[model samples]
Target: MSDSQLISDFFSRDVLLGDRALKAAVADRGEEALRLFIPEQEGYGASGLQIEQRLAKLAASIGANAVDYLIRVIRNGSWQSMLSAAPAFAGLREHKQRATEGLVDVLKQGEIDSQRLAIEALGYLGADDLAFCISEFAENGEWIPQRDHRRQPSRYHLDKFYFYVAQALIRMTASLTSVNAISRCLRQFRDFLPICDEVLGQNRISGWDVRFVQHNFPSRAADPLVRDWIASDSHFLQDCGVEALGHLRLSRTSAFLLSVLEDPRFNDSVRKTAGISLSEFADAGAAAKLAERLNSASDSPGFSWAFASLYAHDVAWPACDEFVEELLGQENNDSEISAHMIYSLACRGDTRAERSFSALNSQHLHMRGTGAIACARFNPESAREALFGRDEEANNPMELACILAAQVHAGHVEKVDSLHQALTTFGELPFLRPIWKREVLYAFFVAEGSDSERGRLWCEAALETPRRVVTEMQALLKRRAREVSANRLPRSQAELASAASRESQEVKDKFDVFISHASEDKINLAEPLYHALVAAGVTVWFDKTELKLGDGLRRKIDEGLARCRYGIVILSPSFLAKQWPQNELGALMARETVSGVKAILPIWHDLSVEELLRQAPMLADRLACRSSEEMSSIVAKILDVLKD
Candidate 1:
């Protein structure tokens, strides 16, 4: 059949999972094929592909040839079609008359998704002239859906249109750091601080995803509204503000959250959550302030105790060694809290950390088994022995799980193995207490990665574990994985490589592992790894075989790199020396935020952790499989993310 007929069929049919169907119809056409389709109720709403990746790839695929075709779809008034084709303008540097006009019409006449499309496209295409039209639509407030009062005030969720408009504005003026840009910031930070005074202001907060009123909000007018959602009992409402605060990391919030960290009015959960939030913005200034607070805070044990709940290694621990020692001597003697303090201090070269842990774990302090657990994070060599010695005693099962988590943080493979064997049900324990899953156990999967041996066990036990915990893990995994792309491939090279392949449409397709190796290791570890992956029923992308290399060899390899969710590198000496493989690894590392945060799983063949860290610091933090392990055991570890 002809291409026109195929495109017509795609849009006319109420196709679900259209990716597979489209791949069959025009395997060669790439994302350009999706645009050629005319209209259908829905074709590609939900698929295996992430919404952002799929949207981005489509925009990237639209060419001058498809501009007219896309315009036709926008005019066709299919919101689904408009969503796909509207982004065409984003890909092209040049504006087309017919297409630009059609999107404008959609903005004026269309409903939610359609209007959202026009707004985003205009913003992305940098349509300054039409910015007024989009702004007018937003200000008119016609899109706000009327709803009942059942959903509490300040807890109402708006459609994604508002976020799209805000994002569009950010994209359009991104080049300018002028006063106008600051003016356009629209009280994002203005209302951020008042929450310190209100402290979950009950009668005050009115709304968010709000009318946003105008381009300019009176600084404190937005205060109660911002404070309301931020302090909401609902996670969804709070996250809307929290995510924005974290991403913007405005200097305003650093002080605000720090104040929230110290305020006695807030409960432990709020204070600790604030501490974690403040930890994200931890700087020398913030650290110094926290330290000063620590020094002066002779009696505010709550301030110091909650601050130690998480020991992010990057935090520059305060020079308050005396303060920490003094706090330890007082009634601030919770074992778990003390353990986190010990681990964090030790990481920053505090000499008293080992001594602190020893006392905390001993009968003299009588702190529970928890101190050994948190201590393991910094010094697994010592924590592992203490953990094992208590195994014969009636130790807390949950507390032992905490120790294993500490070992996961330390990331010594031998020690990790020793600790896991001691715990036995390493994956199942932390999950039993759902609260700990967020507070304490997110470290378990983040550090080990959701594809490690422990992750595999976690996934297996997920069937028996509470659904909320499983859902939390999945969400956390995605959030941790998503970061800003620092992709190493220059645009020109990316254009000619796996990016431009026919498999560009295969955004949803994922293999278990792409065996990235230096060709030199095909004999020693690479070949065996490939066969082992295949034997374990893994969807291995070995590029078939080394000898089968052909003209499309680079393209095929690139496709494997792009398509695979995990890139298990055979990081041997030979692999480290090769420039192409290094670039491949760099590309994978860049996509860690864009694709999977823990995408690169290294196979340290004849490479020490120190050597790996020196050569590729990015991969060193990821839990790696060793080439020295038995092939079966290695593949079992590799399948951790997939097996469940």
Candidate 2:
């Protein structure tokens, strides 16, 4: 058949040989066959979803083998084709050098949508050198507001090219600190702030990007500008300032934030935000001042004092007790404040608050819950008694959850079991509030013991719970598991080094280490460690380093795992929840069992020994290190382990 006939036959649903014909066409005609599906034309006769899926599958099949053809599709095909081809290009790790060159070409020449796809692909491929390329596009790109003739105020839209480019840069820099790529890009686009502000005022930008700036770019040169925004009449600007100040934690701004809090002239939102920001400061004076304000104020200004008290506790200010006492003395009888005071006292292990155990029967259910929690810390028996005596029929889920949490704290395993039975029995009742279900799940999570086999059984049950409950329970379990791991004795230096040597001798591998981590942790903890390992002359097989354009991601990762002498499992909340990392860890464990050699190195990040035990009991006894230690020190220690 002629090429046209072949193309026609391939897209024809009636043709049994369509898949075969298309494969042959792609192999023979390359770009020509791919281009047919590029535009929204009659010849390319598939629904949008069908077209996208078909194109994605075809691109994956061709992969690195047809890098040139894929590049042509990106360069010459219609917008639709470019979008479909971008993922293929990103996945082509074997041909990364060529694929990146092609993507950069498309980035320079393609339309806004095409540019966005290219930018995203490049980011996925870890092309950090192209940071300038992305920043340049963002700087030069125009704002194209969507036009609507029917509407009076036309909705504003940024050139999505610039927006995606900024997004991509943030992703790339998230895991890396040496580059400071995000700050650099922000500086380059500093002149565009007015335009950005205008667009932001119209709510054109996503809340994610705004939060990203407030979180990641704090203490930058632009912070002064952000501070100026606090004084602006615009609520958006004020919100941004409050968020930035909280993250920045600049002690210099404590006085200003306190002023904002004390000034009744300001709106409640801004004043409340200032109160939150003031808590971020480690200054004891700030905490004292806030306590004084709480004491003198006629009415409770929402939960500002509660926030301030919590912050004081977090910083471990010596004056926290004084602040808590001041708050307790206040005539304001807000349940929220009372609960917070009880919680603060509980966290501090202060038995002086035992006098307030009677509040466990308070009319306010939340206060009762808080009181139970406080009682559990100082007197577990009292807490258990208080909880058991409560009228079960009248109690809400929050109250029940608090009671169960207190039971967990008191180590009343039998009571916890009874509560779980009650929750499971009536959990799905139509009349029960959704919050009750969530609280029950949380109670189970907190109550479960790290060392207990029953805890594992409960977690398995929690997994089978409702979607929301399951998600919350899983997170809680993971967090508790990390805590367990953290409290355990870490492996000794000599032992770690000995294990690394033995694994190296056994595997005879090309790479010294394989980093298995969750994508969510890539920016904050995983990538930095990956880079640090590489810098320390460790032949690390990290995804960002080893995976190139047009390569099969899973296949490459598997190969790295097989060839590497040792594997580093960076355990975090994100890592525990991700299936891929868990799968990789499972494989690593299998290898260790098969070879009868120690191979996996667990690196704890914000987790405990109990939390680790909940997930991997086998690993609980094994020596591990923490991400909280100095990065360089951690690297040096790992290198010691790697060295023969």
Candidate 3:
């Protein structure tokens, strides 16, 4: 009956009757329910009609995901309410052209959330006309000003605003023919970089969300501005600026980053960020300098982070013997940083570290845990000793399960019994057991044993574990079954044959063509090629359309490559220019070399023959076509090869 009552009902989880009634009322009565409760929010002074209009605006926004409600409100609400709710309407692409005036009014208000939503809606609808509006906002206006403490935006409003900004940025980037529009917005916020840097230095944001500033940084944001940021008195700004620059992969920023790394004034996190930035910039000298900094025992933590960066990007950051000895000798160090040190040293697969890990019979649970994980990569025997619960003293079920999985990975038959026992004993701990349980069991089967009894038990247990855990269990069990029949470890000849057999079966099951294309050129060629193929009596597996469920995209692509009659790639100007496309082409070329399966059929779109020949000489030598009709013709050739 009132807003207070409604708010109270919203929060009261236990009041089932009231919650049900409120939800039902919202569903059934819609605007009528709000009119009746007008006194609650705005008091007796607010008229019923005005209350209805306001409630409709709030409803349209807050429950914007309810497409039906959004459509109804956009079509029926007053012009002002419709305008305020236009973004939600545009998301559904259900608004009439008349609603554009209403949307403009809301856009003019320059409320960050509204503007973001409007921009997002425009993008969702692919309304090219909104380009001018987005540019105007980027140039002349600001994101809704950060809310003051007393006048803070609601959480819903803030979330909506952030979501809109992310979507808008993506859309605006798409709208620009060149990087100029994106560059302009970034330059406008160039003044904020120091503030961003300062915030980062203070660790104002967590590592995961640091990408917010990083993603928004312009390609040219790495100018002398970064040097100014590092030299500034504000440590916070300098830290964040370095991290942002690293993420932007600005090689030009590496010299400046290296200089900062040499300075003792910069904190460990700042130095680490700079080191990683240097690696990204591909400054081999910077990597060597960072490695040199790791020469001392005290520099271990900084070195570990830098080492991780270098390792990821395939950079040559040598691990010094002194550092390796210091790390192996660090049994008494109790900080979480010690775990990082252990991980780094273990990553090197130094026989000394391996020996030290094996020799450690009674290490701290945490150290053993880290060592177990690290040793899994190389010496699974040491990993098992440090991790498996084979002895009564090695009774960390969590560590045991993990190490057992590692042992299985290393194909250590000796550790199979220990892995089985650990899984049975520790599989009840949701945090520890659920994930590694299946992996350890898979390893058990891989260790040359027919534990049909254990396999049956796990199969039953898998059905009851959470859905997230079940799929992994099923995959592991099926793999184990094939392994058992074939009588070989995962890496053995028999296992390889089984894998080939399974892959060949899957290929026969799908029997569709895999079309690979760069996302940027999706609109111009990839999208049409997929449609034309589907229209031309070919089953199509276009990633954007068929790979709608997000997880395992790369795996799906690989599977398709193995199974498909052919792989049709649209090679355009932007496609060849991008690293990801190059990677796909390289993979296809590698596959062809090994299998002699001419699966990849290239289609050249708008590229000169010479340009194609020069950029991708190997691909240019293959059968390719220039148009959709030509693409269809090439498909017949592919079918002929598959048939043969």
Q: Each model's TM-score?
A: 0.38, 0.38, 0.38
Candidate 1 TM-score versus the reference: 0.38
lDDT by residue (25-107, candidate 1, tens digit) is 54676654654542434434322112322343444455555555555555555666566655445555354355567667766
Q: Who wins the lDDT comparison?
A: 2
Question: Candidate 3, residues 1-644: lDDT per residue as tens digits?
Answer: 55556644432322232334456557756755543332222222212221222333334433424444433333444434434343333233334243444444546664554455455445433343444344334333433323231232233443334334334433333223222344443332234333323423333233434343244343334432343444556565567667766654432344456566666788776776665454333233334445555444135224444443233222344645564455445566642234444544433433444543553343566555545554654355445455445334556776666556565555456765665566555534222222234444445444544334444334333322222222333322343334447553334324422433343232363756777788888887788777777776777777786665666967876766666666777888888767666556555654442332356777787788777644544355455677556656765665665566
After TM-score superposition, what is the CA distance of residue 497 in candidate 2 from its true location, in Å? 32
**296: Cα error in model 1, Å:** 6.1
- lDDT per model, in order? 0.47, 0.54, 0.47
**Model 3, 413: alpha-carbon shift in Å?**
13
Q: Give lDDT tens digits, candidate 2, residues 282-347.
A: 334344445555544323343344342343232324434565565665424666556656655544
Model 2 score (lDDT): 0.54
Better of 1 and 2 by lDDT: 2
Error of 2 at 318 (Å): 7.9
Model 3 worst lDDT window (10 residues): 43-52
